[model samples]
Target: MRYYFVLTIFSCVFAYEKDLTFSVQAGKTDCFYHKVLPNEVIDLEYQVIDATHGELDISFQLADPVGRIIVADYKKSENAHRHTAALNGDYRFCFDNTFSTFSQKTVFFDLMIDTEENQDKEYDEDKEMEFGANSAESYMMRMRDISESVSRVRDNVSTARRLQELHSAHEARDRNRAEEMCAKVMTWSMVQIVLMMTVGATQVFFLKSLFEDRGSSSYKKLIPGLGSQ
Candidate 1:
C-alpha cells in the first residue's frame, strides 16, 4: 500500500498540463510544435476568444513528425481532440486566419501527454486491487469516487465561468464600437449645421448690398435732372 501510494504521487507529479495563449493577425497563421515518443497518447483542447469578428471561428491542423497531416479542422470556435503518436519525433499544430481580412483573433490551447508505459493499465489495476483489499480499502475507494465526481463538477463549473467571461468581453467590445460610431455621427451632423448657417448668412448679406446700390444710383440720376431744370 505504501509503495502504491508513492507511485501514485509520482505519477500525478509527472502528469502536467501545457497552456498557451496567442494572437493571430488577419491573413496569417500560427503554429505550435511538440515532441513525443512513439505510442504516446496526447490530449488537446482549445478555445478562441476576443476576435475582431463575431463567432470567432478559426482553422487548425495537426501534422505528424514526418510532416504528414493527421487532423485538420476549419472554422471551429472550440474543440477537443486526442491522438496517439506513432513516430518518435516532433509534431506540429497550427491555427490559420487566411479567410479573415481585417479581424484578429486570440486563442487559448492546452495539451496533455501521457509519457509512462502502460500507465492507464497500471493505474486501473492498482485501483481494483485496493478496492478489494479490506473494509477500510472499500471505504477509501468510495471516498476516491466521491472525490473524482467532485473534480468533474469543478471542471464543469470552471468551463462555464470561462464561457461567461468570454461572452461578457464580447458584449463590452460591441458596446464600445457602437459608442464610437455614435460619436462620429453626432460630430458630422454638427459640422453640417454650422456650414449651412454660414452659407445662409453670406447670401442674405450680398442681397441687401445689391438693393442699397440700386436705390443710391436712382437718387443720383433724379438730382442731376432737377438741377438742370
Candidate 2:
C-alpha cells in the first residue's frame, strides 16, 4: 500500500512538469512559436510597446504544431481568452501589421501552456529512441534533417506516452465511480424491498383481525337473549 501511494505521488509530480511556460522579449511583431499538447488550452499575453512611437495595429494568426495556420484574426486582441490548442505540438502565434509598416518593431509576449494527458506519450518516445538507434544509417540521416523536425518528432512521442498513462488513469477513475454507483443502487433497492415487505405483512395481519371481529359480532347477535328466555 505504501509503495502504491508513493508511486501515485511521483506520477502526479511528473505530470505537473509536462506543462510549459515561456516568456520572450519584444523581438518581432511577426510570428512566435509555442509548443502545446492536444486538447490543452494555452493563454498568450502579448504586450507590444510602440518603441518607435508608431501607431501599430496588429492581429495574430495561430498555427498548429506542424506549422499549419489555424486561427487568424486581423483585429487587435488582448490576452488569449481561454484559447484551446487544436493539436499537440508547437503552435505559431503570428502577428500581422495592419496599419503601420514600421522598419522594425519589437513585440513582447508570454505563453502559458497546460498540457492535456501528455505524460503517457513520453513512454512511447523512450521506446522509439531505443528503436531508432538500431535503424539503418540512412534512416538516421533522414531523422537528422531540419534539426527542428527531429525535435518535433521527439516531442510528439513524449506527448503520446504521457497521454497513454493518463488514459489508464482515467479508466481507473471511471471504474471506481461505476462501482460506487452500483453499490448505492443496490443499497437503495434493498431498502425499498424491505419496506414493501413490511407494509404487505402489516396489511395481512390487519385484515385477519377484522375478519375475526366480524365473526364474533355475528355470533353475539344470533345468540338467544337470557331475559327473554
Candidate 3:
C-alpha cells in the first residue's frame, strides 16, 4: 500500500516534454493550436534559425482564449513567453515569415502545461500527512523528499536548455561571419585575375608594335620618285 502511494505521487508531478521541428515557407505564417483550461500555466519556448539568409529573423504572436493577441515579437531569432490561461479555450502561437519573399526558416519550439491539479494533489498529500489516522510519518517525509527532487530536475532541465540555445545563437553568428568573409575573398580573387589578364594583353600589343617593320618605308619605295627624297 505504501509503495503504490509513492508511485502515485511521483506520477502526479512528472512533466511531459513536447516539441516541434519544422520549416515554414517564405511569405507564409504557420500556427500551433493548443487547448488549455482556465488557471493552467503555459510555458512556451521557441527559436527560429534562418536557413537562407544571414540574420534573417522571423516574427511571432500569441493569442489568448478569446483570440486577443497578447504576446508579440518581431524580427526575432529566439524568444520565450509564459502565461496563465485566464479562460478555457484554444490558445494560438504563430510564426510569421511573411516578411521574407524568398527565404524559408527552420523553427524549433517546446510547449509545457503546468496544471493547478498537480498543486492540488500536493496540498491533499500534506493534509493527509498532518491529520490522517494511520499514515506513516516516514512515508510522508519520503514523499516530500521525492517531490523536492522532482523540482530540482525541472530546474536543471530548464537551465540546460537555455545554455544550449545560447550556444546555437553563437554558432549561427560565427557561421554567418565566415560565409561573408569567404564571399569577399572570392570576389577579390576574381578581380585580381581579370586585372592580370588585361595587363598581359596590353603588354603583348606594345611588344608586337616595337618589333614590326615600319611598312611605310616599303610603301614609299614601291612608288618610283618617292624613294629619291
Best by TM-score: 3
For candidate 1, the lDDT comes to 0.73
- Between candidates 1 and 2, the TM-score winner: 1
The alpha-carbon RMSD values of the candidates against the true structure, listed in the order shown, are 8.2, 21.9, 6.2
Among all windows of 10 consecutive residues in model 3, the one with the lowest summed lDDT is 215-224
Residue-wise lDDT of candidate 2 within 158-205, one digit each (tens)? 567555544554454456456766888999999999999999997886
Residue 34 displacement in candidate 2 (angstroms): 3.4
The per-candidate count of clashes, in order, stands at 0, 16, 0
- Candidate 2, superposed: residue stretches over 4 Å from native: 1-29, 66-68, 75-77, 116-229
lDDT of 1 by residue, 14-113 (tens): 4435766788899999998888877787778777765776557899999998899988999997787888889998899899998899889888777777
The per-model lDDT (C-alpha) reads 0.73, 0.52, 0.75
Model 2, residue 182: distance off in Å is 72
Model 3: per-residue Cα lDDT over 18-86, one tens digit each: 776678888999998888877778888877644566455789999987889989999898888888888
How far out, in Å, is residue 183 in model 2? 75
Give residue 88's error in model 3 in angstroms: 2.6
Please give the ranking of all candidate structures by TM-score, highest first, separated by commas: 3, 1, 2
The TM-scores of all predictions, comma-separated, are 0.54, 0.37, 0.75
Candidate 3: Cα lDDT at 156: 87
Tell me the lDDT of model 3 at 5.
59
